[model samples]
Target: MSPKKLFARSAAMIALTTASFSTFAEEVNIYSFRQAFLIEPIMEKFTEQTGIKVNILFANKGLIERVKREGELSPADVVLTTDISRLVSLTSQDLTQPIQSEKLNSNIPSQYRDPENQWFALTTRVRNIYSSSERIGPVDITYQDLAKPEFKGKICTRSGKHPYNVSLVASVIAHEGEANAKVWLESVKANLARKPQGNDRAQVKAVKDGLCDYALGNNYYLGKMLADPKQVSWAEAVNINFPNQNTTGSHVNVSGVVLTKYAPNKANAIKLIEFLSDDVAQQMYAEVNYEYPVKVSVQPSKLVASWGQFKADTLPLAEIAKQHQAAVKLLDEVKFDL
Candidate 1:
């Protein structure tokens, strides 16, 4: 035990200890299709409250395979996606775990969550019509009215295969019956002001360009357009309408999250999801994304509130996921090119 040998041993011990301490630091890994900036505040809040660092991999594509490839080695504790169909796909593939959070169960409405707790809807958005403020005067329009001959060649929408469109069409099927919904879809297809092409915001732009008098858009798109300083003119050109309020109300969709089946940090993941379901986080979700908080007690953003309240189709959103294949087939039959 000479001085040089003792010094070497001490250094080796210190290195090993540092590595061990680093491994022990609390962390939760999340794979989210939602943009990093959009969910940063929530992530920060979770970290601040629980002192657990969240490592997020944010990508819109290839995340599913990445998770599958990672398999038992996957570090992802939770996944956040925008639609029920996508959530269902993940669960069907056995990539997600059933989360049993009482807070989530109590806060989220049954209509907004999976029956088996495989996923939970965090926020909701309605698929409603956006009309040109100057060209279209104040008038009520129903999803049914979109098929009217008077509106032919005056409507715009995104591609039919899109989950939003699929779910929207599914709601029609649930409400109007398949045969009637198919007939309505065909009629609406004939009315396309322009070939289905672009995201919801683009539909608004088309309306601005006078390519069409009206467009189908989700409520959040209107919120994003209105919030964008550069898109102020685009915002000015259109007015929001919650269709069929006096009848069946407007179509709605959700942003939901699920725990990974092999989550290494189940406790932390449960805490994170529960935190998101609570009032403060729910309010942040509504204000930041301009979406309706799933929590009934949480009010919509001021901009959303201004649009006024409307009934939303209560078809178990799981049905939208279940009927997604049928919706896609119908969209194809109707020839919605996007």
Candidate 2:
């Protein structure tokens, strides 16, 4: 089904469900770019504990546009999405309202949230470099190393336009400045094993199949690949290396939430957002989605924990967001994907 049709159907279903409930039953509506499966369990637990009916419309894209079209009449209380870009889009478009919650402030670290509290990160994942176990074994590397002559024709990645890669490029711009980052991007383009193609997991599969010696992928994909029976070999064939450990450390990104500006159930929405930031929901995010919890008190699932800790770049996410446009322009300048 088209995303629009699917969104309409899902919204209708949610409306019916909400209407069937007792009139007094509190409810909150969500427009989410996140997959339903990853969040349903946590929502169910929240419903059980608070008796607030949760209505969700899940789409891979267009939630932001949909909310914009709905404007003041929008039923959406919250917007849930992955990546810093989407989170920034919410505030940039003026679709979200600032939230003031002591619980949220204490649970999420400053670096992971909007300074204005318009959005709060729920989970974080590292942008890791996966090295072929059979070819390269374990090695310490940095984003800068990917551009070196020694690694030419040895790396694989997704499209430069992909949010994950774009964010990585943006981070380079954030740390190295546009001129240096452009040069690095040009050299990295020269090093591509093939034109950048496929998702992060596909890059790992490329490494496993010996298409390349290295792949840039998110950290959670390794945990996910290990759990999938068909992909365990891909997981086994690579070592998850944290880049820039000796310097600025690995770049990290987040999945986050925003309260809509015209929420009909503001109180319940705040309650739900607070619940998501708390230990119970944060733990579910870690265990169920293979993501690292933003809540400092919550530890990662056992499998994710086994991948020893590493230093994450201290560059604020807002700093990375600032470089997004420059990063995209640099990618185009280098013709990185073509």
Candidate 3:
């Protein structure tokens, strides 16, 4: 073969390989505690924009422990969590790295992100009160108000140790002192219609079944139930009430993300996180999952909006997270589940 022909062939092969790499640059592996359906769309959009595929491993528990066990060899690029405490837990374990991204910083409000930039809340869910339509009329209630004498034997909830309830309880500890929060938990526990059992939707169902008149549950579960054909009736029997609008604002928890300590594809992972915080992804979070966007510019879904607005507590997530152990201990102290 001639020298010119060989040189030309080599250049063509090099260009082809480079273009192939550019076309599918990398894949970002996510260890997500969030349900697959809730976040898959946002990830699809990220891939569409950046050409970086997302690989998600979704589970109900133990993702953080898995990451810790894997250590530096962990393939996780980002850890996606449905609650603020896990994000803080991942950070506390030194399993995540601080990211300094202006895009991330600007997109997520300071109130909804880590002071050190280790975790960025993509969306927020309100732990709302579901009141029986037949028993309770349009009523204004607060989280603190539920513990009053009149509400005894009127509340339904899941196991108090569940992350959702713990986060809410932790928020209480944040807003009030630990002693006051403990007393309040005891009062609320005394109000339970039965021993704490079932998921959030069951609490709503319990209201419909007349098992209880008021249930503690996350606001988004109402949307989940509304979409389920069989559970639609259970959903219709309750009114979504964002409690504490009159005081310290509604107790809100976050679904957040962290940059893992062993992110092999760090650049691609950062792009995915940036995409999630952008206006488009924020809109998807509200529309797809009925959660509030962390971005101030993005509006909540119409259904979520129709529930009307409530002031979201601005307490830093870290503050609430710090109280998680105390919340759990108090639940055990009160035997809230029993």
Please give the ranking of all candidate structures by TM-score, highest first, separated by commas: 2, 3, 1
Q: By summed lDDT, which 10 consecutive residues of candidate 1 come out lowest?
A: 16-25
lDDT of 3 by residue, 193-310 (tens): 8999999999999999999999989988888899899999999999998888888888889899999996867888898899889998899889888889999889999998899978
Pairs that clash in candidate 2? none
Residue 168 lDDT, candidate 3, scale 0-100: 91
Location of the lowest summed lDDT over 10 successive residues in candidate 3:
15-24
In candidate 2, what are the lDDT values of residues 1-338, reduced to their tens digit? 47875565456445543223111339988888888889888899999999998877778988899889877667788999999999998899999999999999999999999999999999999999999999999999999999999998899999999999999999999888899999999999999999888898899999999899999999989988998999999999999999999999999999999999978789999999999999999999999889999999899999999888889898889889989999889888888889
Rank ordering of all candidates by lDDT, starting from the highest: 2, 3, 1
Candidate 3 wrongly placed segments (more than 4 Å): 1-25
What are the models' TM-scores? 0.91, 0.93, 0.91
Task: Output candidate 3 Cα RMSD.
Answer: 7.5
For 1-338, candidate 1 gives per-residue lDDT tens digits of 47875465445334432122111348787888888777888989989989998877778877787678767556678888898788888899999888777788899999899999999999999898989988995468898999999999999999888888898888888777788989999999999987888899999899899999998888888788888998778878998888988877788899989999977778888888999888988999898889999999999989889888888877788876777777888888877784
Poorly placed runs, candidate 1 (over 4 Å): 1-25
